[model samples]
Target: MSTVVAQTEEPEFDLVEAALALCGGDAHATITALLDELRFVRGQLALSEAGMSVGFTRGWKPRFEIEGDT
Candidate 1:
């Protein structure tokens, strides 16, 4: 039996490398920065959801609602 191997092409720009370069190659710093940005985005989403009118949203609700969240 013969098996065929698949090869993947590398991207022109590496996002992981770019992120490391921006954080001076500190892995911890890169992770912390990403987490902070995620928190900020989630907060913004929550605010937007809170402001949305039930009528405007047509009674639509988030599929997953976290406990203790308004």
Candidate 2:
């Protein structure tokens, strides 16, 4: 009989726990600051994974411009 080795996979990071770590025991501050940072980081990572195709650019301009009648 041959024995097979089992491989173990690591668990994913919990946003709440990471946020708590950043909070340093302050509930309100943690919620606002940590959450904001988490959101920004998540957005950046998502965009990078998507090849950054959906965001805005500085040089983009509308083809038609509206003018007020005098």
Worst 10 residues of 1 by lDDT: 61-70
**Candidate 2 lDDT by residue in tens digits, 1-70:** 9999999998998977787777776789887996687778777766655553334544443322246884
Model 1 scores a TM of 0.60
Off by over 4 Å in 2: 1-6, 34-70
| Residue-level lDDT tens digits of model 1 in 1-70 | 9999899997699999999999999999999999898788788878878889889899985433477857
Question: How good is model 2 by TM-score?
Answer: 0.35
True-vs-predicted CA distance for residue 50, candidate 1, Å:
0.5
